[model samples]
Target chain A: MKKSLLFLVVTVFILSMVLSACGSGNTNGSNEGKANETATNQPNADKPKDKVTINLVAFAQPHEQKMYTQLIKKYQEKYPHVKVNYITTPPADYATKLQAMIAGGQTPDVFYASPENVSFMVDTDQLLDLTPYIEKSDIFNVDNVWQKGISKYTRDGKTYALPKDVGPFAYVYNKSLFEKAGIPTPDPKKPLTWDEYISIAKKLTLDDKGNNPESPDFNPKKIKQYGAGFWWHEPAVWGNGADYINEDGTKVTIDDPKFIESLQFVADLRNKHHVVPSSEDESSMGGYTRWLNGTVAMFPMGPWDTAAFWDLKFDYDLMPWPSNNGTWGTWLGSQGFGVSAKTKNPQEAFDLAAFLSVDPDIQREAMTMGLQVPNLIDMAKNDYLNMTDKKPVSKQVFLDVIETNGHDWAFEKTYDREWYDLFNSSVTQVWDGKKTPEAFVKELQPKMQELVDKSIEKKKKAQAQK
Target chain B: MQLTEKKKEMWIAYLFILPLLLQFALFTVGPMIFSGIMSFTDWNIVQKASFVGFDNYKNLFQDEKFWKSLYNTVYYMIGIPVGLILAMLLAIGLNRPIKGSKAFRVIFYMPAVCSLAAVAILWQWLLNKDYGLINYALSWFGIEGPSWLGNETWIKAGLIIMMVWKGVGASSIFYLAGLQNVPKSLYEAAEIDGAGKFGMFRHITFPLLTPMTFFLVITGLIGGFQLFVEVVIMASNGGDGPNNSAVTLVVYMFQKAFNYYEMGYASAMAWVLGIIMFIITFIQFKFQDKWVHE
Candidate 1:
C-alpha cells in the first residue's frame, strides 16, 4: 500500500510540472491576443467615452523637441478624450529606426517626414492621403502655407503630408568681419551679382601679410581668413538658373552649360580665387567653427541656424544669396507631419497631424524659437520678419527668397535616392578638383537617367498590380 | 523496474536541455537558413520577393566596386603579421620578472577593451592633416606629415596602423599566457649546457610558442576581414574615404542593405564573404601541422 502511494505521489508531481508549464504558455499566448484586441477595439468601439491613444513620432532638434512637447500639451488640453504618446528620436538614427519599426508592423499613427523621404514613403504605401482631410478642415487652407513647401509633399494631385516649415537658403554675414575688412555689407533687398560678390570677397579675404586677393603680393598658401563658404552646391546652381532635373522629373539636366558655369565658379572660390577655405581646411575645422572664430565673413546658411548664430559673440545679419544670372535664387527644404495608413482611427490621426503642422500658434512658436521658418506665409512675413527680440536684423531676406527665388531642392520624384547618391558621389570629384564640372556632369547624366527610367518602370508595374 | 527508472531520468535530462536546443534552432540556425534562401531572391524589405537565381552573384562578379572593396579588405589584412610581431615582442618583454609586470599587463590590455568608437574618434583627430598632434610633432622635426586620413594613398595605411595599435594588446596577452606555460626547467637545462639566451629561445621557447602563434594568426585573419566600425566612425560624414579608398566589403554590404534597400544583393555579398572566410580558415587548419606544435 505504501509503495503504491509513493508511485502515485511521483506521478502527480510530474504531471503537475508539465501542466504548469503548459498553463504558463497558454497565458502568454492569451496575453498577446488581449493586447491586439485592446489596440484594435478601444479606439473604435468606445470612441465617445473612452480615451483614444495615438502614437506620434518625430526626429527633432533640441529646441524643436521642446516646442513639440508644449504643442502636444496644448493639444491634449483641447481634446481631453484623446491621448497622444509623443516620441522623439535623434536625427542621426531616426530614419533607420523608423524604417525598422514600419517593416516590423509597429507603425506610429503620425510621424514627421522630411522632403527627401516623402516619395519613398509614398512609393511604399506607408502614408495616408491627406487630401480628403484637408478639404474638410475649415482652418487648414493650402493657400495659407508656402506653395513650395506644400508642393514638395504633393504627388499626382494628392497631398501626402502637411507643410510644417520652409527652409530657404540665405547668406548670414558677420557684421564684425565686414567692418574689420573695411567692406560694406551687401544690401538685403538687392543681392549682388557674381562678379560684384567676388570683388567684395577679395576685399574681405586676407593673407598672413595682410594682403587681399586683389593685391599683387598676395599669397594663396598663407591665407589666414576666407571671405565666404559655400556649404553645398545648391545655392550656386539655382542662382545660375540651372537645375539637376527637368520639370516632369524624367531627365537629369546636370550637363547644362549654366550648371557647369556655376560649378566652375564654386571651384574657383577655393582653387583660383583663394577667397574660400580649401576642402582640407573646411573638413578639419568645419564651417561652423571657422565662422565662430571670425575667419569666415559670409556663410550661406538656412534659417534653422538662426538661434545658434544669435548666441555668437559677433553681430550678424541676413542677406539674399549672390545672383549668377541677375536673379536671387536658392533651394527650399521642407519637413512636415504625415499620418500612417495603418492607423485604426484615421480621423483622429489626421486631426493630430493637422494640429501639429497647420496650427498658426505652433508655427509662430516654431519660428520664434528658431526651430523653423514659418510655413504659414502670413506668419513668416509679419511675425518672423518683424519679431522684436530676434538677433537677425534682416529676417526679411529669408521671406523674400521664399517669395521670389526658392525652388524645390532639385530632387526628382522617382529614383530620387539612387540618382542623388550617384550625383553626390560623382560631384565629390568636382569639389575635390580631380575633375572639371563639364567632365563630371557628362559622365554622370546617362547613369542618372538609367536609374530614373528603371524606377519609372518599377512604379508603373507596382501601380498595375495594385 | 530499474530500466523504467533510467528511462524517466533520461527524459528529465532531455527536458532540461530542450530549452537551449530550441533557442539555438530558432535564433541562430533559422536565420542562417533564411539568409541563404534570401540570397537567391530579389527582396527590398518592403516588397515581396521574387526568385532571381544566380543573378545577384553574377552581378557581384562584374561589379567594379565589389572588386575594389575586396582589394581594400585584403590590403587591411597586411596588418596581421605586423601586429603579431609587435604583440609577441611585448609578450616576451612583459613575461620577464620585471617590476610592475602585473601593472604593465593591465595597461596593455586596456586599449583592447576600450570602446572602438572612442578610439576611432581619437585617431581621427590625431591623424588630421592640419591640426593633428602627430603633424605637430612631425613639424618639430622639420618634417611635414602627409595628410593621413584625407589622402587616398595614405588612408588604408592609416587604418592599418590604428588597427595594429588597438589589437596588439589582446594578442600579446594570449602570448604571455603561452609563455608562462613553457616549463622553466627547459630554460634552466639549456642555460646549464652553455646555451645563450637567443639559442634557448630559438630551440625551447619558440617551438613551444608555435601553437599560440597559430591560434593568433587564424583568429587575426578572420577579425581582419570583418573590419567595419573604425572606418565608419572615422569617415562618418561619408563612409567611403577619398576616392572610396577606405571602402571594405562589409561596409559596402551594409550600405547596399540599409541605405539603398538592396537586401538581396547584400545577402549574396555576405554569403560570398562567408565562403571566402571558410575556405581560408580550412586552408590554415590543413597546414597547421607543419607550423604548430601539439
Candidate 2:
C-alpha cells in the first residue's frame, strides 16, 4: 500500500510540474481574450470602466526615462482605470529585444522604432497601421508636425508609426578655439562654400609648433590641432547633390562622378590637405575626444547632444554646414512611437503613442530638457528657438536643416542596409589613400547593386507571404 | 504487491536523473532539432517559415563573405599551435625547482581567469596605433609599428597576439598537471643509461607527454574556430574591421542572424560549421594512435 502511494505521489508531482509549465501561456491567452471582450464591447467609450493595463517598451536615457515616468503618472491620473507598465532596454539591443518579444507572442502594446526599421516591421506585420487612429485624433493632425518626420513611416496610404522627435545634424564650432586663432565666429545665417571652408580649415589647423598647414615648416605627423573633424560622408555627398540611391530605391547611384568627387574630397581632408586627423590618429584618440579637449575646431552636433554639451568647459555654437552650390545638407534622424499589431487594445495603445509623440506639453518638457527638437513646427520655432540660455546660440540652424536642408540618409530609405554596409566596409581603402575614390566606387557599385537586388527579392517574398 | 529491491533501486535512480533528462531534452535537443529544420527554410523569426529546398545551403556555398570569414577563422587557428608551444615551454620552466615558481604560476594563470570582455577592451587600447603601449615601446627601437587594429593586414595578427596572451596560461596549468604525472623511475632509468637532460626529455619525457599534447590540440582547434567575442569587441567598425579582414565565421553568422535577420541562412552556416568540426575531430581521433603514447 505504501509503495503504491509513493508511486502515485511521484506521478502526480511530475504531472503537476508539466501542467504548470503550460499553464502560464493559457492564462495569458485568457487575459488577452478578456481584454478583447472589453475593447469590442465599448469601442467608442471615452474612458474604459474596466481596468486596462498596457505595456510601453522603448530604449531611453536616464532623463528620458524620468520624463516618460512623469508623463505616465499624469496619463494614469487622467484615466484612473488604466495602468501602464514602462519597460526600458539599452538602445543598442532594443531592436533585437523587441523582435524577440514579438516572436515569443508577448508584444508590447506600444514600442519605439527607428526610421530604418519601418519597412521591415511593416512587411512582417509587426506594426499596427496608425492611419485610422491618426485620422480621427484631434491632437495628431498631419498639418501640425513636420512632414519629413511623418513621411518616413508612411507607405502607400498607411502610416505605421508616429514621429517621436526629429534630430538635425548641424555643424558646431568651438568658440574658444576660433577666438584664439583670431578667426571670426562663423555667421549663423550664411554658410561657407566648399572652397571657403577648406581655406578656413587650413588656417585653423596648426602643428605643435603653432605653424599652420600652409606654412612651409609645418609637419603633418606631429599636428597638435585639427581644423574640421567631420567623419560622416553623408553631408558631403548630399551637399554636392549626389545620392547613394535613386528615387524609389531601385538603383545604386554611388558610381556617379559627383559622388566620387565628394567622397574623394573627404579623403583629401586628411591625406592631401592635412587639415583633419588621419584614420590612424582618429582611432587612437577619437574625434569626439579631440573636440572635447579643444584640439579640434569644428565637428558635427545633433539636437540630442545639447544637454551633454551644456557642461563643456568651452563655449560652442551651431552653424549651417558648408555648402557645395549654395545649398547645405545633412542627415536627419527620427525615432517613432509605434503600436504593436498584436495589441488587444488598439485604441488605448494608439492613445498612449499619440500622447507620448504629439502631446505639446510633454514635447515642450522634452525640448526644454534638450532631449530633442520639438516635433510640432510651431512649438519648435516659437519656443525651442527662443530659449537663449541654451548654448548653441544659433538654434535657428537646427530649424533650417529640419525645414529644408536635412534628408533621410540613403540607407534609411532601403528595406535592408546590407548593400550600404558592404559599401561602408569596402570604402576604407579609399579613405586610407590606398585606392582612388573613382576606381573604388566603380569597382564596388556592381557588388552593392547585387546585394540591393537580393534585398528587393527578399522584400517581395515577404510581401507575398503576408 | 511489495516492490522488489532491484526495482526500488532502479526507481530511485530514475527519479534522481529525471530533472536533468528533462532539462537536456527541452533546452538542448529541442532547439537543436528546430534549428536543423530551420536551416532548410526561409524563416526570419517573426514570419512563418517557408520551405526553400536547400536554397540556404546552396546560397551559402556561393557566398564570397562566407568563404572570407571561414578563411579568417582558419587563419586564427595558427595561434593555437603557437600558443601550445609557448605554454609547454612555460610549464617546463615553472616545473623546475626554482624559487618564486608558485608566484610565477599564479601570475601566468591570472589572464585565464580574467573576464574575456574586459580583456578584449584592454587589448583594444593596447593595440591603438599612436598611443598604444605596444607602439610606444616599438618607437624606442626606431621602428614604427603599423596600425594593429586599423590596418587590414595586421588586425588578425593583433587578435592572435591577444588570444595567445589570454589562452597560454590555462594550457600551461594543464601541462603543469601532466608534468607531475611523469614517472620518476623512467628518468632514473635514462640517467643510468648515460643519457643527459636533453636526451631524457627527447626520448622519455616528450613521449610520455604526447597524450596531453593530443588533448590540448583537439580542444584548441575547436575553441579557435569559434572565436567571436574578442574579435567583435576588438576590431573596429562593429567587428567587421577594415575591409572585412577580421570577420570570422561565427561573427558572420551572428551578423546574419541578428543584424540582417537572415536566421535561416545563419542556421545553414552553423550546420556546415558543425559538420566540418565533427569531421575534423573524427579524423584527429582516427590518427591519434600514431603519436599519442597512451
In candidate 1, position A159 carries an lDDT of 88
> Which of the numbered candidates is closest to the native, going by highest lDDT?
2
- What would the per-residue lDDT of candidate 1 be over residues B74-172, giving only the tens digit for each residue? 999989999989998999999989999999999988989999989999999888878888889989999988777766677898888899989999999
Q: In terms of TM-score, how similar is model 2 to the real structure?
A: 0.93
lDDT of 2: 0.87
* Model 2 docking tier (incorrect/acceptable/medium/high): medium
Off by over 4 Å in 1: A1-33, A36-50, A457-465, B1-24
Which residue pairs does candidate 2 place in steric collision? none
Write model 2 residue lDDT over B203-258, tens digit each, in one string. 98778888889999999989977989999898876778888999989999988887
The alpha-carbon RMSD over the true interface for every model, in angstroms, is: 5.0, 2.3
lDDT of 1 by residue, A233-316 (tens): 777888888888888778888889999999898888888888888766665677778888888888977788877787899988
Weakest lDDT window of 10 consecutive positions for candidate 2 chain A: A39-48
Clashes of each: 0, 0
Model 2, position B123, has a per-residue lDDT of 92
Candidate 2's residue-wise lDDT over A1-466, tens digit each? 7568769867987787677767865776667767767865775667537667889999998988998899888888877767888999998788889878887888899999788888888998989999988989875677888988888888887988998898899899989888988889989888888888898899999998999989999999899999988467888888788999999887999999889988998999889989888877877888988888888999999998898889899989998888787778998889999999988779888888888888888999988888889999889888988999888889999998888889997877678888888888888898899999988998999988988888888788888978
Candidate 2 error regions (>4 Å): A1-48, B1-21, B97-103
